[model samples]
Target chain A: MENLIDIKGVRHAYDTAAGKLPVLDGLEVSVKEGGFCAVVGPSGCGKSTLTRLIAGLMHPDEGEVWLHGEQVKGPRSTVGMAFQNPVLLEWRTILQNVMLPLEIVPGGLKGKAAVERAESLLALVGLEGFEDKRPSELSGGMRQRASLCRALVHQPDVLILDEPFGALDAFTREDLWQTMHEVKAKEPFTAVLITHDLRESIFLGDQVVVLSGRPARTQYVMEITRDGPPKLDDLYTPEASERLATLRHQIEIAQGRAEEGVSA
Target chain B: MTGTLRKILVPTAAMIIFLILWEALVWVMGWPNYKMASPSDLIPAYERYWELFLIMGWQTLWRTVLGLLLAIIVGTAIGMIMGFSRTMRDALYPLLVGFNAIPKATVVPIVALMFVGAHDFNTVLIAFMISFFPIAVSVSIGLSTLEPEYRDILRSLGASQTTIFWKIALPKTLPEFFGALKVSVTLAFIGTNLMEIVSPHGRGLGALFDSGKTNSDYPLMFAVLIALALLGIVLYYVVVALEKVFAGWAERQPG
Candidate 1:
């Protein structure tokens, strides 16, 4: 498969009042076309910054971030992004919010077709009969679902999710994982999910990349293979346990706190 | 249903109780009508001087409305410019804050000098100067509080700055704008009355107060004061109605 996203020797930093603070250093990642890539990292490890870079919301200070064959210059209309907060406009109804991207991107969807597309996406996310309701009227999970529809309605080339389900409870989070898997199965797109939950990464991701603490770099990349579908039972197996142990050990080492667990 | 009824009923009950207490105090004091008119005296005064009260009340109402309208337009524009540009905010915000600190009463004489005996225009000008700062400041604050991620969402979708302003920024400011308007309209009424008092001609309801003071007609003075209080209440309700119509969406709390 061709590489849909390529980040090579990228370094990024924020200039604060004190001085320039580095967030990413010598970062390299290659995601194949139509691949689901999950990046797992500790808090404040620049995981969200990686999504911002891939979405072209910001420029890397050094090296290149290529989407397809071309270098990313600025915000790309072809990329869809969702943050931890749904960021729905309170003034707009759910359907209108879903159609927001179409109104923004020049010469994109509009009129009757836009409405139909937004409605269909809402239905796909189990949000039928909620077209006219304002965002404040919906539950957090429902709002997130509506936002997911908004992100996907434009049919973007890539979808970047930055801790999209991190705010939800355990049960809602698990349910959304299934919903996301089903949606991807229905309509495939290259995806990058930035998360700290190890089980979530292993469950939803085709390839899980562990990232070190700030200034971040890739620590280990593991491909989650299974004979059949990934079940909750799979997490308890010896193979899955071993994989978890290895990744956890790598993360501890990356965070500079792996003294006692290095031999385990 | 009960909430709506309670909103109306509670204020009405309180006003009635207040009026009874005021009447009791006036009766017990046994002051002359010139010194302190009772509620009984006020009713007859209203009947006798209804024509004068109506004309002066209309004058005050129009001035207050016009002045507040101008303030809304000018203040919102200045605020938008300040909100959109960092340089403008940095340059103007401190100056506006300093300007707002000065007593608006002191400024009315200066404004009166500009119009130079144009009573109506002076009243409007004073009202506008008094009311516009809160609108401008609140609007600036509203625009500043917009989540950075909201801008990012629009930007990532390749939205132009104009599109962001119209669709997101303007709508986001509506609740704050209305909140400022509610405060500004009350200030606007006070400004008109203050200018009316200081103006040589003593225009509007303020003229009524000035004349009543000179003539020692306490009943007429009480009548005009009641009219002014009613005017304030009505104007405040106008803003409340507008808030309900425009900012109803903002009131929805997430379950």
Candidate 2:
């Protein structure tokens, strides 16, 4: 598989009033074309920063980020993003909010074409009739679904999700995972998901990358050998449980919460 | 009562109770009409001097409206500049604070001096001066509150600053703009009234009060007060209605 997205020796730091705070150090990642890569790390591992770097929203303090064989100098129209919070404009209806990118991206869809694209995307997320409703009127799950539609509306080459369903209940989160899987399967874009949920990472990602603590580097990378997208029932299987336990143990040691050489 | 009916009835009942208490206090105190007039005296006064009140009240209301309209344009432009540029904010914020500190009433007299014989211009200037600061400050604050996440999302989509301003910043500032308008509209009325009170040309509500005070016609003075109060209430409600129409998204809908 060809590398669709690549982050090479990237380092990022924030200049706080106190001092310079380093977040990512020599962090390298690569995703193959049409791959869904879920990045899992301990909380505060600068996972969000990585997403920003990939999306080209900001420049890295050092090193290079490449998308589709070109260096990412600035924000690209071919990159789509959804955050943990829906961040829907309160005044816009669901359909309008989903269509926001089309209006912003240069030479993007417009007028009736934009509306039709938004309508079909909404339908994919099971938000068909809720098009005219304000975000406040929608449930938390519904809002996240709408947000996903917004991110995908412009049909970008790479989709970056920063814990997109982190605020939802467990049930809703799982349901959205299935929705996301279906969307990716149908649309076939390279996806990079930053999440704290390990189970979610394995469930949705073809490849999972884990990062260590602050000033994070890639600690471990796992490729699931599953034949197809895992169903909800697969999560309850013994094989899934063993994989979960192994990942949890690795994360505990990586976060410095457990001794590396000791058995619990 | 239904929710809609209760909303209307509750405020109406409160107003009725307030009036009854005011009447009782007047009767018990036995304060002459000059000091305190009951609703009985107030209603008859309105009927007898309806023409005077209407003509003068119209003059005051139009001046207030004109002044407020000018303030909205000037203030919002200044606000957008201040909001978009850090240097502008740093340069102008202290100056605005200092200008707002000076009593607007005192400026009225200075404006009168500058204009000399132009009473209406002086009145409008005073009104503009009085209401400008609040609108500018509110709009600037609203623009500043554009969320980091929103910026990130828009930037990721390759949105330019101009697009962000029209699509994001402008709509977000509307609720704050309307809030400032409500406060500034009242200030505008005060500005118009201040000019009318001090000016020799007494053609508005302020002039009615000035003449009534000179002649010791307490009923006429009280009548003017009622008209001013009604004018303020109506204008405030108009702003409230406009806010509901334009920025209804900011309001909390009942479940």
Candidate 3:
């Protein structure tokens, strides 16, 4: 199977007033075709940077990023992303926000069919009747749901979620996680999610890539198994809980080193 | 009992009280009627030159409205260019700010002298000068704050620049554009009036007031001043009403 996303020893850093600060230092990770991969790390440890490299929002200072076997030269609209903040446009209604990408993309989506596509996407996220309501008029959870629809509306090959459920309450986040699982079951797509939630990473992602501290690179990759049906029943089992704990310890140790470097 | 009445009650009561005090102060101090006309005394003055005052007021209003409209159109265009292009903004913003800092009233007479026009072009020019900067600054700020998430989302979805501007930029900046206009309208009126005070062709309330002062016809001056007040109030209320109609959109806006 072709690797939908291929990142090989990518290095990136941003220019700041102080000086150049390193982010990703020779980090490599690849998402297998149709696999849900989550990169979990401390804040600013280049987990989100990996998403940008894959989505073509930013280029790696050194190294290659490939999407669907093609080298990413610049931004390709074929990747869909939702940020931690819902980022729903205030002026646009829920449905219109979801329909925006299709209008922008050269999909030739027009008239009633386009509208129906938007409606089905909105219905998929359980915001069926909220077609005419603006983002400001909706609750935080509802806004995020609308955001999911917007991400999927154009049917992009890759969907990237950067802490997508970070701002939501625990209950809402869990609910959306289940919804995402169902959505994936129906229409399988390659996704790279950057998250801090270990259980969430284990629950939704087929592969979990854990990073070292700042100036970080891929340190570990763990594969999760679902024999037949993807169910929430085994989320808190001993094996899953132990894995979650070990992931937490590794992240904490990596973070302590980063903090010490900052002080020094 | 009435919604409309409730809206105006505080301002109306305050105005009534002010008039009553003015009437008392004049009568008690033995101030001459010509020196300071009370609200009741100024009532006749409005009727005496009703036709002339109306015409002058209309001229100023036209100048103010057209000037502000022009400011929004030109300002938003320039602002969008500045907002989207970093090179343009860095090069132009400082120069624009320098222009904004210079008071229009000081330069109005010179501008009017340079332009040859039979109509109230001087007043219009003054209004435009005063309004232009505020509109430009507000629109530039509004457009610059175009949410990085917006570009990210659109880029990921394969959105082009033109579509982003029309569908995204225009609607987002709308509330702020109107807010800028609200500020611009007030300045436009002041600038036009200041020009009227100096221009050869200005027969507006400013000139009328100047004439009344020179001729020592305080009653006529007071009456014309009242008419000018009414004019300002009308223009201000018009913008306020527009904001009311667009309030739903404004409420959604982030500051």
Highest DockQ against the true fold, candidate: 1
Against the native complex, each candidate's DockQ, computed on alpha carbons, is: 0.81, 0.80, 0.61
What TM-score quantifies how close candidate 3 is to the native fold? Answer: 0.90
Q: On residues B121-233, what C-alpha lDDT tens digit does candidate 3 reach at each position?
A: 77777788788887777777878998887778877666678777877777777778778877788788788788877776466777777777788878888787677777777
Pairs of residues clashing in candidate 3: none
Off by over 4 Å in 3: A256-264, B1-30, B86-93, B116-119, B241-247, B252-255
Model with the higher TM-score, candidate 1 or 2 = 1
**RMSD (Cα, Å) of model 2:** 2.5
Descending-lDDT candidate ranking: 2, 1, 3
Model 3: per-residue Cα lDDT over A200-236, one tens digit each:
9998999998888889888778888887776677787
Give the docking tier of candidate 1. high
- Candidate 2 per-residue C-alpha lDDT over B1-255 given as tens digits, one digit per residue, 9 for 90 to 100: 899999899989998998899899999999899888887788877887789888999999989899999999999999988987889999999999999999987887788788898878888888898999999999999888788788888998888888888888899899999989999999999999999999886568999899889988788888888789889999999999999988989887887
Chain A: TM-score in each model: 0.95, 0.96, 0.94
Alpha-carbon local distance difference test for all models: 0.89, 0.89, 0.81
**How far out, in Å, is residue A128 in model 1?**
1.7
- Candidate 1 docks with a DockQ of 0.81
Q: Rank the candidates by DockQ, best first.
A: 1, 2, 3
